[model samples]
Target: MNPFNKSTGRVVLGGAGWSRQIVTDPTSKPVLQTILHALSLGIRAFDTSPYYDPSEILLGAAFSDPALTSKYPRSDLLLLTKCGRITANDFDYSPAAIRASVRRSLDRFSTTYLDVVFTHDVEFVSREEALGAVKTLFEMRDEGYIKHVGISGYPPAVLADIAVEIRQKLGKPVDVVQTYCHMNIQNTTLQRSLGRFYGDAGVGIVLNASPICMGLLRKGGVPIGELGDFHPAPRGLREAAAKAADWVEGQGENMASLALRYAVGTFASVDEKGLGVTILGGGSIEEITENVETVKKMLKMEDNSVEALDLRDYSLFDEEAYKKDEPLFKGVRDILGEWIDYTWDSPDAAFLEEREKRKNQEK
Candidate 1:
């Protein structure tokens, strides 16, 4: 299940943030340059999806570039793409559809085999459909079309449970599992549940995305990013995020810098070599550079120092639940208490809500 060797570091370059830009921009030259720059910074893994507009095509063109291909061959890079969820309200998990999706991704990515392929946002579909798509992906892996198979979604519990379900049914474990918004400073759900994933489901690698929690943990903090239109968080949580930013600023530290370092430090290998992987999205060259520099600072910090331990352990959450101390961290945690483990309603929830509305109208 663990395809990567000990030498492979964990920083993955994500293509979602650049999804819009790549599609609207007339030239691929800028994005290509950013990709090349990221590669130079030791980011070997790239994560993209068909749902993210033209991300797959942009990455495909970047890799297909003669200059880039010559510098970093396709074999050296780990290319990961997702399927199933098409739009906010659209998702298709049938085996036939999945097979076709893989074909399209393969064609678009210009690769015969994908290093990893995840069933996107499994939380939105029926459990049967999600597992069915995963089983199909397993078949694809067996057929030599995919090197690894897994699922991606919002709920950490659901992802871990499905991984266990796959093992029970198939007699084998998922090669990798990715869950976002769980490992960041605001939420520590992943740390508590990772043991189940590693021991019960036998997941090889645990991939954490949206380290900044999709811009919720950014400099501006609350009122999150404009991307909230697609997956809007609760109003209370947004206000708490804003408060946390103010608190962080009052402490003479930048919210984003602290957040980035905390995440990278927590997941990163303590030794010189990076042990764990974290997928980071950057729209520009400066953003990518800043992320790399943050890790460098984390790497150089003395292991026993208070700052290092604080960043690594974070102490925001315990095994049982998230802690309510450290003033700033506690203040934000308290505001999010009601929705601590809460995720926004999925498409399935929306369907049920609509059904209820119709029944009420009939009555």
Candidate 2:
């Protein structure tokens, strides 16, 4: 049986957005409230990372709170996090660094073991280093510090190829693989690679993150505040996204909502058992509520269903509403045109060269 088949695991609550809040305040009440509200709505899986600075701390506090622990025990929740990528321009895949990072995450989360611990953004490091990190994680798994080992990165093809290599060298398949931006509206490359992940690599779970392309597909354009400047999309993609957002708004629709629904619907429809899980992040309770509602609508759950009724108190989602938005979704895709499936180089060429230079110096 698929371990993630439970409703709670279908949509994972991502912790990166929480890290954005950490920039202004050490602990954010709004983030905590949003998390508590998500729990009340039956969200059980959470994805975080040490690199997402204090995300693990904030989530740890909430998870340890009496109000939360009383109702939801540690065993009932799925805690997923990552290691290796330490900062924006820094990455350490050394076995010692990987082990230290995992221990730190465990300390921050106040938990004995993480449900999943990925070698965050493996593409940034050398292939030998990436495999070494995964092997180190496997060792921790055997030692009972981690339940599963995985990898998360931007390039689906690179990630898929690594998964295959891990299986061949390590003698066992990775437990999970996560790729962001590739499964969203503008790019469906992750969908094309799903067969490779499942059939060739024997991956157990494939997670799709950044359904809205890290806010690029939204109406206001890529957010320009604290967490906005870090977006790596080039001018061409950004301009195309703006046009798509404009067209979507002209039709009296929200670009982000439509994109979210499209992504969830597409992934859920990949196969009978579902080919992927979506990792989503929201800065507020309203946004989180809307995200969960979109998931309910995409899965075609009944209006009177428990999860739906909890989130549907304010907005109603039904087949008629979903069908009405299809054309607008198509229009946005049409506007995207040439930018469709376009992938920008992550850790761009300059950074890769600089990183290699630094590694050589260390040697």
Candidate 3:
């Protein structure tokens, strides 16, 4: 069966927003409101990870609420979740561990089957471990536990390589892939590497998250508390982003909204036929409203005077349309020229140090 044949919507409601008190707090009205509102906005997919605290349970409860059950039942939504890389310092790719993780996720989400299950953040682990996780997920797929199986990671090159490796070892293509921060305005690695993932590696659908690149592209900057000390990007990139945000505001547009528009707009407008989904995290009802509005504008622009070109407009394989329409953003790209496509290390040095400590203890 074609993996993309199902009703996987173009936009997915991200569960990262519910990671902390939003999900942990049982009476969080905002969480329920956001999910209901998202369903109203035509978002039929939800992406969550076990590592994201109680997100899975929170989403499950929200979907099963009596007020929403009949109007938007579990059957109405496409459930997507991930396993492996449990925390910054914890990662388990063993077959038995992965199998157990999936079962626990099923319980947490209160679902019989998952629409998709991804091996989260495969770059930090060894190839053998990563492939083992994918193999087990594929096994789960065959067992009728998951409809589609795939992997997600930060590095496009690493994700592409692993997708190809999985196809070679398992004799089937990866059904989906989730990569964040790569398709945003500052970094377009996902766009540049689309051909490799779609053609060479055989990824059926691609999901892009963090249109604002984890708040680095927010006005001022990402608060140190929100992302902690290991926030990845260099100080220079952060500073440049702040300046760009101010520059964008001077042009009378919200920086975060503009970034969202560019990322969501380009992907939704492009008629490539290859399925793509943008995962957006919403904290409150207003945030969900803003996201839905951004998507509406994205769709409207195609019929309006924007004359936005289709994905075909980009030469043979490139998907970075921001560079092509650099003139529209009023030199924001020029201001960030020094940091374009610049990526800091993921599973940062601190994470790596803890990884070694864990290994030593295990040994």
Candidate 4:
């Protein structure tokens, strides 16, 4: 049976944002407490990557804590990590490297197997290399080191095409596919490709990550601290998003909350079978609690409220709040203007050229 086919909840706790805090101090009690808090609140799945430095190590430490193990057993949780892309400009897609990465992740997490492992940021490397890495993951899946295999990147079309190609060549569909910054208020490109992912690619699950577009949709503009010094969005798009954020804030509404509501509500409404998942990030217990509460409220508002509400017993339904924020959502979208649905280039030309230069020297 496909591991993704099991119920993992609609929202996954993203480890990237929270892990950034502990890179210097991996044993930070506050960060570990945040993880425990999320688990206590019923978040069963976690998304992490070795590329995020100490993210894997931090999460491993959290899971190993007696506080977590005593209450939530390994079987009750889902661990999702990635391989291939090592840093902003480094990647290794060789089968040997892929195998080593998975083994290393296992050792770091102190787990017998990972629930899912994605070929991290496939667009950064050549298609052939990405496919080779994915094939290696499948072999590891068979060996029980991984339970599922998939690919993740910026371009939804590229991800869909790769999923189709994998099915054609390997005779099995990818267990899951993750695409970030494409399903938020500004960009809904991922929604358009859902049919292809489900019907054409036969993907078992599709994870829509970065509902806030990696902090691009927030009031403070694009973040440029520990995560990175640059954002992939062009100047015009960034300007438009700034205007949108200002509009939302002027109306006394939080931009990030509105974006999260729109994303969670939209995805939850369309995904009747619950095969779709949204990955959200938070840096503190307050942020995680707020995000989870926002998700709960959105779930309550969904047409299929019963199933979504069943995940948590508490009721967060507030029709009045929803009604008040509905207009703000539309207003922000209008402010986005022509930038809506736009996708910026990933692994931009400069990086591609640099990669080619390195490859040529090897020959």
Candidate 5:
């Protein structure tokens, strides 16, 4: 199997987060071209959910483009969709609803089957409800309408717990798990916990929170709350973000460079031999182009280290506390003072609670 397949490379590109940009475009030529360009690059994994506005419709449009399918058959690419959260509805994990959603995805994409189908509400659903839905998805897979079965949610603990259940109850490990483990506006301690946890779980994990952290980390004290959930540069995130921005500015490198490097740094440790696809969403062509270049640069960097840098050299860093002054953000003390101060209790921690659990379980 290709490492980049649903099993190995671990990178899953997100589609719905581009709802405002991709879905809103009816006559847009550039966006459609960019999507094709990405497909041409061997980055085949795509992710979408109904909650992302009209992502399903927009993606269908891109896939249905005559120029694209003519060159690359739909079978060449692997597609995954999450169910449970709908635009005007709450999270629903009922077996009937799950089956209907998969059918809708198959019908919308004009594909005969799904490459992978996730419950999307894995974290919120109880053991029994999840098992019930999982049963139906497996049946679909057995029937050849769905090729793989996966789950995704905001929280990793729930993700792990359910993943364990699937393995034990059905004797088959899940094919993929999606969660937010981005570079910027993220909790490092929590990320470490989850990465280590999932690594140990040996289940294929596709990270969705990559560019999200980059967008925030590239900033020098930018606002936090208003950014997209796909781009949440949280309130306190501005504080740490400012320091990183300053450092990049001082290095004479572009913000995009530092952001891309940091986004993939930790989860993609060279030592661990890890890899995953990340969604690089953009509101415009230039933004997408710039991001693509950044990803290229990050790949070309001399340092193969995927772990985040230790800020001890910059004076703003307190390695013991993982806290640094504004200079730590940039490697600028004064600049760090102006950032939005973030707390550990933020919801992001809950996002990676499974990492924490895995650590405890090991102990």
Candidate 6:
């Protein structure tokens, strides 16, 4: 761990290439204001990607902001980017594309070498494709153009497997692995391996896309993304979300308070070395600031390892993978009205049945 990482603790703010959907939208003004606001807090890490629409451009604007640069030294910060996906719906993992992407990111973000660059989207591609993409990232890392090398994939998928497999071939452990480990679903196999990878391999893991699914567990008929709406639902989907909402809403406090607490605390308590970083997103600077403070409070609470937030990623069917797996939705029972607790004490067969069905499909 470097001085910059230890000082910031284990949290990475919303720079994780997800800025396009939430931050740089038309309605939001003073776009750079959000970045300024986050920097005002103790946040020093920024993850970004050319994949975000005009996001690299917006970050360049923030980096050059006189007031922000004055308050925080430019060299004092860490800026991360990725390659492999550009625009909204495309996948290009060629080595040339990766090089072009990094160079373009430099031009856009107004930064020299990236602090970290991952093989952007590793889930859909095969291991061979991923290795090729990673080869480029490692090349940059070797040139000192990229300080570290990593990969980002969601769910249990290929990235998890590749992270472990690459160790033998690369002769060095991966420096970072960015994945979505949230308050909803548990890739138990992946989670168990992640701690070891971080410990034995000296790999740093970055968590993203939290609070979206968990945020819905608290607020009703509200969407947390850029311009989403929680609307009419099918019997199955509504049943799932509504059941979890029952337990989540009854507490009087929002699930965001509990869920975010669960994420950081869960990883920190059990893993001896602990989760290296978490990158969260929000609607405003206030939202970002609130997230940081909330995480600080949650880490102070109980650290239970069993807490799970699994999301179903049926974008064509629902709110994408961002939905389905939130921990807040665990209150779902069935037509029989049994409470489907995600905890250890639930014995509802209907709840068990539905949960099992989702797992079986992953096979």
Which candidate comes out best when scored by lDDT? Answer: 2
State the displacement of the C-alpha of residue 134, model 2, in Å, after optimal TM-score superposition.
0.8
TM-score of each: 0.82, 0.91, 0.87, 0.91, 0.71, 0.73
User: In candidate 5, what are the lDDT values of residues 83-119, reduced to their tens digit?
Assistant: 8766322457788998898888888788888887888
For candidate 4, write residues 249-295 as lDDT tens digits: 78888888889988876675565345457898886889898898777
lDDT of each: 0.72, 0.81, 0.74, 0.80, 0.56, 0.56
lDDT of 2 by residue, 109-130 (tens): 7889999999999998888999
Clashing pairs in 4: none
Q: Which of the predicted structures, 1 or 6, would earn the higher TM-score when compared with the native?
A: 1
Q: Report the lDDT tens digits of candidate 3 across residue range 166-243.
A: 888888898888898987778877776677778877778878888788777778676343335545788899889988
Off-target runs (Cα >4 Å) in candidate 3 are 1-8, 21-29, 223-230, 268-274, 301-326, 357-363
- What is the Cα-based lDDT of residue 206 in candidate 3? 79
Q: Tens digits of per-residue lDDT for model 6 on 28-62? A: 44657887777666667777777665566777677
Cα RMSDs, all models: 6.3, 3.1, 4.9, 3.2, 9.7, 11.0
Segments of candidate 5 deviating more than 4 angstroms: 1-12, 21-30, 87-89, 182-186, 189-202, 220-234, 242-247, 270-273, 300-363
Give a tens-digit lDDT track for model 1, residues 152-212.
8877888888889889987888888888887767776777667778888988888889877
- Model 1 misses residue 108 by how many Å? 1.6
What is the TM-score of candidate 1?
Answer: 0.82
Q: Against the hidden true structure, what lDDT does model 5 obtain?
A: 0.56
- Tell me, by TM-score, which candidate is best: 2
